[model samples]
Each structure stands twice: as structure tokens, then as C-alpha cells.
Target: MTTHPLLQALLPLVDDLSRELAEDERYRRLLGTLRALIPCDATALLRLDGEQLIPLAVDGLSPDTLGRRFAIAEHPRFAALLAQRTPTRFAADSELPDPYDGLVEEHVGHLEVHDCLGCPLFIDDRPWGLLTLDSLVPGSFAQNDLDNLEAFARLAAAAVKANQRLLGLARQAEAEQQLAARFREVAGQAGRAELIGQSAAHKRLLAEIDTVAGSDLTVLIEGETGVGKELVAQAIHARSPRARKLLVSINCAALPDQLVESELFGHVRGAFTGASGERSGKFELADGGTLLLDEVGELPLAVQAKLLRVLQSGQLQRLGSDREHRVDVRILAATNRDLAEEVRAGRFRADLYHRLSVYPLVVPPLRERGRDVLLLAGHFLEQSRARLHLRGLRLGGEAQAALLAHDWPGNVRELEHLLGRAALKALARQAERPRILSLEACDLDLAGTAAAAASSVVVAAEPPSAPLNGDLRQALDAYQRQLIQAALTRNADNWAATARELGVDRANLHRLAVRLGLK
Candidate 1:
């Protein structure tokens, strides 16, 4: 007996659903098949994550829709869908707000979906997520359509379960073989780069990290040198679904221009003069994981072009190789340089900059993070105390004032190093063994700095503002003189230390000091 064409079409879909290997491919094909079978305007599959529904695969929705996380309490439609067992269809004129309003890609300008159908999926008799179909036309779904959708929902659940089981086994095997000592070392380093601040700035940064971590978006982290951009990258990786996999980091600036391409894309044997063996690149190593490109603004133009192609297509060919390999890597690019300005100056590729900055996260400087300075100082003090074998360590009131007043040009790293130096100095000066090691303002060596003295200056004389005449050059000269003098005082006339603190060469700083009549 011959089977019907509808059954014939569906048999292949079911077979494909059972045999597909990649989870993303399976989801894409599953959604495609459902849309073909049900004739819906839009369809989405969401997975339950804690109290939120995370979009796994979406068809006919806005690109940004997949990046969104719908909280159960925030969306009444999703809440209603989860509350019921059977397929729930909302009327075209239902009063309840649609979670995906204005989110459909094709329809713009506050478009409200007229009809909606949702069915919750289950695995092993427990709730997993939901499959949703939406239409712009009124009453588009009939009873038969609902029934068909319900049946398809069952098949989708089976496909999801099978795919998850396969993933579990594959991950188990990969974990067993790939969790080497290098992974442990990287994990430990990531653990140490914690975001430790309670200020509003810090809270906002943390919130941004949490929101973007779950999605496979390319993130660009911009900040000044030593502002803890790597820590932000680490936090994103730790919070992502790929947290179990390796997070490979490469410093673009540290590598020579000649070797940057080879380091990033790897090379086969005989690719270069010293190409002794075939090797996997960072992109390959970071497959199913994340790759952090530190100081990405430093990449050569040729390498940047290649990087852009790989990012766009997820395809790369090793050096001197004809065959192309596919990799799945979520990229996180970081730099202290202003890439936008670099693009304008022709120093960086504009296309590459746009590609890398799909999601930009800026780490606030230490000076802007107000009261967080003390909290971070306390943290660093404890670390120093333990590392330096001190009995007890505490910042004195004057020391706290000095810390709050300092500009912290080098940010958290400078703060950490300063605390370490202060602790050592305090320990050395203590002739008798004191029960509590106290770090005073003098011990911090910031007495003559502009920041330290600003707190004590009379308001009328200094005013903490530019001069009324607005003589920009004169004002800058005065400010530079103050900074140089403060650095010299803090360093006890040690020009090298002063130059280091000011981030200038020793001879240059000395020349500037002499020019300003500070000799």
C-alpha cells in the first residue's frame, strides 16, 4: 500500500530529528519543519533556565529576540502558557499583553501580534520549556491547527531529549579527555579575576555581564590599561553555558606581527620555516567555548581581515592549507585603545571593529568608582597580609582618606601593588612585634600628592575648578607641576619610581620636571 504525501513528508522530518547530531542544527531543522508543517508566521523554541525562558532557536523573529531572556513574572503570556498542560491559544483581541510585541522582525513600529498559540514541552514527565507560534492575522489557528501543533510538540520533545542525551555523553567524553592541567591552570586564573565591588558602577557592570553571558554574542570590552577588563571577560565566560569548556586567551599585543596569524589560526606542517608539526590554533582550541583576544586593537591589518572572515562564516583555513575547517567560538575582544578613533585614523579596520562590538561593555575606571576604593582596598589588604605573612593588617583612618583621594591612574592593579608596598614598608619600620599591623597615611607615601592634599585645601583658594580666565595652557602647566611634585615627594626624590608612577620614561619625566622649574 502507498502512503500519503503528508505522511511521507513527516516521516523524513521525524527521521532527521532523531539522527541530527548538532544541537543547534537539530533545533534549526526542527523549527523549520514545524513551520513547514503548521504554516505559522513565526515560531520559537525556548528552554527553561531557572525562572526565565531562554530562546534556543527562533524562526521569523527579530535577531535581537534570541538575545532576550523572558522572566516568568515579567511576561504574562509565558506565565499563562506554563500554568496550563494543554495547548493554549489566545484570542486575537485578548487583553493580556504579548511578550513578543514589537519583536517580530518583518513588522516594525509597535506591532502587536493578533493571535498566539503556545504548548509546553515535557521531558520524563517534567516541564522543560515551551514551543510558541504567533501570527499577525486574527484567528489564524483553528482547532485542527492546534491539534497538529500539539502532535508536533511531542515529536519536538523527543528530539530535544535525544539531542540532550547525545550531548551529555559527548560532553562527558570530551571532559574526560580535555580537562588537562592547562585547563585547571586557566580555571584557577579565571577564578582569581573576580569582580569585587559593590558600587553602582560595579553593579551595572555585573548586570550587563549576566545579561550577555548566556547568549553567543561577540563582546567588546573597552577600558583603560589595568582597569580589570580581563576580569570582566572571565566573569562572562564563567556565567555562560560553555563554562565547563576551556576559555582560551591570547594577548594580541604581546605577539609579533609575523606570528599573530599563526597563533590565532594555526598552521599545518611546512607552512613556515619552523613549522615542525601540525598544531591547533586558539580558535580550534576554543571550539564549543570562548576565546578572549586581549588588546585586539593591536592586531595587524592583514590578520584583522582574516579574523573578520572567520567571525563572519565560522570557517577558517590553516596557513598553507587548502581545506577549510569549521569552528564554534564565542569571541570576546578587549582593548584599552579607542577602536572607534582607530577606525577613523585608518589604524584599525572599520568592518572588523563593527563585527567585534556587537555588544560593548566598558569597565569604569577606579577614580569613578567612589567608595568602592575602600572596599577593594580592604580586599587587597587581606590578600597582602596572607601573602606577606603578617599577623594582622588594617588601614588607618588617614590611609583610608589617602586611598579615597588618589586618582588611581593605573586602576585596580596599581592599587593592589601600592597596598603590597605599603604593607612591606609598615612591617620593616616596626621595631617591636605589634599585634596589629597598621598602615598609616605616611606609610602610603601619598602625603604631598594633589589628591591627598585636596581634601585639606581651603575651598576659596583651590576651588576644585578651572580658572575663570580659562587659560588652558597655564592651567595645564600648573596641573602638571603639581602631579610631578607629588610623584617626586611620594617617591622620596627617586626619579625612576616617580616616572613609573606617572607612566613616563625617567629621562622624560626629569626633563619635564626641570622645564617646570621643579629641580
Candidate 2:
């Protein structure tokens, strides 16, 4: 007994339904099977997420397609497809514009009126998402094809459901759900502040965050500047038991040395020359909550002693007052500097470093996270689109290539700022507000930026000209100081870039800089 062609295609997915395949692998195999049966030029399975449709899997499309978020309101064709219950095939000459213009693989220019078919998937009798197929040839998908796609759509929904169940079985699912819900709430009210990535480095970071968030252990988040360490802290607090309580943060580097003690442990009237009245410090304000000591490496040795005492006893006195107040606060410290090296250099106290680094979390730099850069770029592009009130914004093929090729020294924050600037540049190039503005390589100018950065490194790497007049070690130290100082000036005091230019590890550079009094 021979089975139907659609049924043959779906049997493998049925097997996949019970297997322990990764979520991405399951979705990819589902799309692969759909393309094999349908013989379409492009196919995608997009999951409906509130007002937007996010691509879960794509076949015969650009890799960056998975990063894009298609808003139903912006794409009329998608809007119309979801409005119906059965599969939809647009007319060859349909006046509605296609959303996948210039997005079909190996096809240059915009996609014109052609064969477009979509089937809306439903789970538990509610709208879930859309299964779409596209081809350059008109009249390619006949009525029979639509019916076959409808069958495939049902199996696709099953695959999605299986993935959901697998996620639910995992112990981390509840925490992830809460995090997602909090993300949605905060995104609706203000700018979005959720981690967006699918790379292995990002997954490792997420696993670590999940592991440490459930406990009250002190966490030292160490990462380069602009790597979103504060976001990591927020994620920990959002997933922790003290989520409902306040998560206060103070920048140690922003305060004067004399005020550091008062800021963290509170101050009373007449404590200092500028002390006007009694005030609650960050620890008091964040009592029974979480407090983030940003730039913790910048704390003076004197203040570090007091902070260590408070961390040890949970008791602190207002400056110039003998009275003590007990509070329960969880400490989360962040720093771009290597505190261990600082301790070795006699700058940071070894005991205080030990107290703060109960569990250290290192955020991988942006250069190490591969395709995650595109996902993050998409996130930022969406934000720019909404802020600038543009109809739509997307990256051209060359622009994506540029982004992928560059080494992101500044990490996620750099990518966000770059996309924001590129969108505006692309918008200005258009004669009028385009329906879908595409950013080209020229708009990004990443190549030019890289060239400039390279030139600066060359200038900063030159050997010092001034002759030395002391012992061998003294001469070497003077030369090192000159090289580091020049690099720092050229790189605008970015220690990471300076380290890179000098061909030394960032931690080693910091230790050397401190020893030479160049910090």
C-alpha cells in the first residue's frame, strides 16, 4: 500500500515529534521537508509573536532572514494571510507588495508579482503562525499545492508543540518564561532590554546566569566595556527570588574618592564639609534587595575595607555616627578591570576581592559571538525603525557581510550604536521615506572605521624616541609607559583597544599600567 506524497513527507516529522532533537534542528528539518515536497525557491516558518512574526526556520533564504522580525501591520500580505483559516495563494498580478523583496536567495533585485503561497498554522485551534513558500514562476502553486501545504502546516504545528513540551520538561523553563514575560512587559513600557542571541557563547552565558540567579551568592560580572554587564546583572535579579525588590546600582567610578565611603555606607550631617543632612546610602536604599556596584574596581582601598566589613556583618554605620543599621542586601559587582591582578598589584584588597567574587560571570565579547551579531543588529534596527518612524529598515547583503567581517572591539553596545547610525544614513540617502529602507555597505562604513582604527594602532605601536637614563628595568618601564600612553591617547583611553594595539593581554596591560603609574 503506497502512501500519499504529503503523508510520506510528514512521516519523518512524526518521528521527530518524539525524538529529542534540538529546537533549531527540528524546525530546520521541518522546513527542509516542506521545501523538498513543495519545490519552491524559498520557504520559511515564522512564529507569531504578538504584533510581529519571527522566523523560526528558513530554507533557500539569506542567513540573516532568521534575524529579521516581520511586523504584520507593516506587511499587508502577511496580514491578509493570517486573516484567513485555510491556505492562501495570492494572484499572479496581486497589487499587494511582497515582504520578501530582494530576500529570495540567488535572485537579484526586488521580487515582483509571482507565485506566493502561505498557510496559517493553528495550535489548539488558535492562530500560531504562518508557513510561507515563494517562487519566481507565476501559477506554480495550484489548488492541489495549497491543500498539500495545509497538510504540512498541521505537522509543522505539531513540531512546534513538541518543542514547547520539551522546553517545559526542562527545569530552566519556568525561569525562562518569567524572564520572557518580564522582557515583554519592560519592552512595552520602555526600550527593550533583553538578551538576544543564539550562539554557543550566548547559550553558555545563559546557562551560567540560570545557575547563579537562584542563589544569594555574590556575583562578580567581569567583561570588557560595552559588553552589557549591567544587562547580565538585571537578568540575574529578574530571575532571582528578590525579583520584586529593588535592584539598585551605583557607578563607583563616577563618584569622587572622598564621597565613595558615604555613597555606599551612608552619611550623617556634618560628616564632611559638603554633608548637608543625613541620607540613606545605596546599601540602605537597597535593603532586602540587590545592589550592583558598577566599576567596583575603582573603589579606593579605604572604602574597600568598609565595604568588606558590611558584606561580612550586614551592619553599617552612617559616617560620623556610631549607631549601626542591619540590612540584607545581595551584592553584584561589575568591572572591566581584572580585580585579581589589581589585588596582586596592591591596589584592590585581596580579602575584599575574595568576598565579591563568590561566583564570577564573564560575558563573552561581541567578536566571539558569531551570528548573534546579526540577531542583535536586527533587534537594534527594529528599535531604530520604531524610533525614527520609518516604514521599515533592513540590511542589504553587502551590509550584513560588512557587519560579519568586522571585529567588534566594543561589543554589543557598539553594534547597537552602529545600527542606529546606519539606519539614519540609509534613510537620508532616499529621496523620500521608502516603504522598506535597506542599508548598504556604504551606509555602515565599517570598512572605513576599521581602516581608521588600524591606522591608529600603527601610530601607537612605534618605539619611543626618547633615550633612557637609568637601569635596564627602569629604561624598559619608561619605554612601556610611553607606548601605553600614546596608545591610550590615540584610542581615546579605551584600555581594551590600547591593550590590543600594544600586543598584550588586557589584564597584563592593566597591571603594567598601574605599576608605571599610567592607569
TM-scores for all predictions: 0.54, 0.80
Q: What lDDT score belongs to each candidate, Candidate 1 first?
A: 0.77, 0.82
Error of 2 at 273 (Å): 5.3
lDDT of 2: 0.82
Candidate 1 C-alpha error for residue 406, in Å: 0.8
The positional error of residue 496 in candidate 2, measured at the CA in angstroms, is: 13
Kindly report which residue stretches of model 2 are placed more than 4 angstroms away from their true locations once superposed.
Answer: 48-52, 69-99, 111-116, 125-128, 135-142, 169-175, 179-192, 268-278, 451-519
Candidate 2 lDDT, 1-519, residue by residue in tens: 999877887788788989999888988899888888888889989988667888878887766667777878877999999999899999778888777755676565654437899989998898888999998778888888988888888888888888888877334544555655664463342423467789999999999998999999999999988899999998898788876677788999899999888889899999989899999999998898799999999899999999999999999998989999999999999998889877876889999999999999999988889988888887677678768876556777888888887777667887888888888888887798887678899998775555443344334477768777886446656766777788888899988777777765476466557768986
Clashes of each: 0, 0
Candidate 2: 10-residue stretch with minimal lDDT: 184-193
RMSD of each: 20.0, 6.6
